[model samples]
Target: MRSPLRSRLVLLSTCALLLATLSGCDDDSGPTPDAGSQLPEDSGTPDSGAPDASTDSGIPDSGAPDASTDSGTPDSGAPDASTEEPWDGGYTVLEEHGDWIDRGRYAPCSFNRQGDPSTVRCDDLSRYDLSQCSPEALAQLDAYGIYMTDLRGEVPRSDGGTGLLPAFAGFMLHSDGGTDTMNTAPLDFRNTDGGTFFIGSSRTNPITGTTLTALAGCQVPSPGIITGCYARCINGSFNRAGTFEAHRMPSHRGESESSGGLRLISESPVAVGEAVDVYVTKNHAYVVSLDRISGTSGGLTVFDVSDRAHPLFKASISLPGDSSWNGVWAKGDALYIAGNDTGTLIYDISNPAQPEYVRHLPAGQFGVHTVLVDGNRLYGMSPDMVTLVYDVTSPLAPVLLQRITVPEELSSGGAHDAFPYEGRLYVSNGFGGYSVMDVTDLDNVRHLGQYVHGSFAHHSAVGTFAGRTIAFEGTEFNGSHLRVLDVTDPTNIVKIGEFRLSPVNSIHNLILKGNHLYAAWYQEGVRVLDVSNPTKPRQVAHYTTFRDGDPGRRGILFEGTFGIRVPGDGHVYVADSVRGLLILNEL
Candidate 1:
């Protein structure tokens, strides 16, 4: 069960809901609150009691060219063909490097020598040398699009030491010349200002009652790439100063919305709060949602997806006072839901379209954020930094096996999610880093080793490629991309390759099907990469599911694809934040 202290921390973290300017709870924190208008679960009724059949969601389309019109070939930017043989256990270990773009030195400016928010002040030009800033390039920026930025820099700590700071920001430049940011309320751009190629935004932290401000004196280092110095102040005191790189997220490398035959089949809206994750089983799609930051409720929304192109709404269920359902999965006749207020909620889905509620596991105030089913074993990751193992040999009834906790859980974050491959379990242990555990015997689970990347380890997909055990790991933060690690030797895991989109967005979940890696990238949309070579991942196909004006679009970094499932049924099931369940044709 979730402790009272952890529950309080969860509430306090939600106070700062802006993903761009403020950090929120980690993956284990359960359903995150979104900054959007509150609507009843039953609002915006679908057509004929089912999702609208239109491929378009009534909002503006992403304007990406149709992939069907492609010439049936990989993009020119794809990696060249390689004839390397399968891994024979001997290979070069690639060293990782910082993702920041360094542009020489900057003129330093002092803030409140004393740690006082009331003494914060903005030093726009004096803080950074702007002689290299190109107003012309900034002016050429797309007047109407969203720019997501990833920032990394150093700040003076109270202990007389320098600390590294990583942050994210989002800017929406309207076609009408007005600008907006995720730091402010949705559609409210009044607190933002920009001239030429520079942009700045300021807001008061309602939770802490402190003044927060940021200024970006930028230079267009390249097309679609904005890099420069930025200063942030809180409560009239200098909080941190850093270098930033912003990427225009609408399109990638001039590619259209889709490529390599991947195309959208249907888009269904979820009227129950903000849709985050989905599970497709027994010819039915089960989507779970979370309450928005506006204090709305979220629950389960079911659909009859027997028809790939048109999904019929079957049922919507929200508990009276506990409605935050973040993850969903099904096995046999059993359906499992990760509930914030409750543990794993079991349901009998023998009827497929109509599910019957069973009982909650470990009853009481247990917080299960995400769940995984491997054979007859069920893994429920809790925000309390513990992974609860269950014997689900009888799918309908689960028996608690044991609680697995890693040393990093307490100091880092908690158990966010896990992937069970072979006799090993790859755990995305929040800030605790990626942990590889020998779980062949749950009774004597042994810690293999851990890869402590300084990013928020969120989700991963592992597979055997060319006789090598490769894991595609991803973090959840601005500028967070995909890291390809060779984990065959868990103790000596090494990063062999990496794949990235815009730094402003984030990679959420990964699904490895054969040699293809399907990812639910938040703002960059659904990305399909060919990882046949593992080290050199190539984008073989993509489908953009995010549009600026989509319904439920909020001023939060996690505003696009959240959950994805490729069931080998020639269809891809996606749970998008705004558009709900998106059915796409598999490549």
Candidate 2:
């Protein structure tokens, strides 16, 4: 249940506008939900400003390691050189099979057309062939965890042909054999151990004002893998149908809950909304969250982290009517917070435990999704397709320098986030792709080049590796993974390596410390990759932060770790949507 004030805040934040640009929403036909929001649990809207906490390029000046010290050998927890081989950049890539099934002709289920989802029956097992399903093997699967399925199938096109459509779904199987799909409980969930799986759920489309029902059935091809088909009906009328391949996210590739030497030190629950990002400075950590549908208000949660094994709650602050704080950064005695309603919220943290509100910059309805500080310059990424540049030499009082905007052709998707490395600004422009800009001279800011990938460009971290400027970019959406690019020559950016987990999961924010790249991947948890070999990124360590019954576990696409910061500290700080602030031992 969302409060009226929050509802108004969502509208004022211009989330719809940001979604329209990032997703290319058709204005005339009404809004089409993003791939992650197709399920009921998702609000189909970006977090206020869609910012990632800890979006800074690297550790700040506050007693953190500098870039020059990042060229050391691999961390202690790296994979053994004798047993593990470097990745060849080869991984399973989903593709369309060009096969189509006409559900209207083969299945007895028909659209109700009356717009009543109750009349549509989805329990007809006769529609699928059970010969290939292995009941014995399925029954042996661990049935009490989370699974994310990726669907890549062909749908009927109006031209009497077929078109490819990719979809993603998440489900939680409880220890009691009960199942929940996308947070929709008591669904028509059934499974023969693990051999045959089926689930049906319904939701009302906010745009079409019609009920949409989805039914999925899969055969267990092997442990942790399910192959099947699904159908979506709108107003009881068959709208789309497709085949799917599901994979269990935990213990990937025979790995356990954790790998290498990464381990959890302590867990602190964040009472404020959905914890998204965090920053560490002055022996304190600042976590920012966004208001969730579960009715929690978003704000800042401060913790005195003087002791690595335990963190003391210092304070929690939620402004009346302005609680959507997404990103946080600090310098000197001034702390900068990315406020969706008010621009950059400045706080005087001279009293480390208590943050006194100083003031918000540029005043009046400025929405900043993420903030980054480099030297004396502060970068605020806005969903309005511009990056706000401010001079923060004075720390507390920042002076607006300019609003950098890319060309119209490359600005369709607004600037989601950016990373500064060596006088160059690598901007993750959603939909428009990744753009490299030269900001050596603010008055003459120039666009170097752009990488036009197909997904929504979200956040990135750049560093020099083996004499080459390497960037690790992560996109937001189903099947999005880490893409390691060689940006030595901005005009010709080439992908040299990549790392992937379940396609159903996503990587939110990441930081590069020396030879290690730490990523806060939702559901996949905290992943530490050894990128000493820029061409082959290998996972050296990991800590799983997602569990079955964690509070605010909605079983949606973006429900796990959202923000991560290394800061060269002996500990890793993460902001989990459910578990809140998690402190882990750094490898």
lDDT of each: 0.64, 0.64
> Model 2: per-residue lDDT, tens digit, 397-453?
999998898888887556778888778889988778899999999999999999876
TM-score of 2: 0.81
Q: Where does model 2 exceed 4 Å of error?
A: 1-74, 80-145, 158-160, 173-179, 183-196, 211-213, 249-254, 362-366
For residue 202, model 2's alpha carbon misses the true position, in angstroms, by 1.4
Error of 1 at 132 (Å): 5.0
For residue 427, what is the lDDT in candidate 2?
91
Residue 402, model 2: lDDT of 82
- Give the TM-score comparing model 1 with the true structure, all chains together: 0.79
Highest TM-score model number: 2
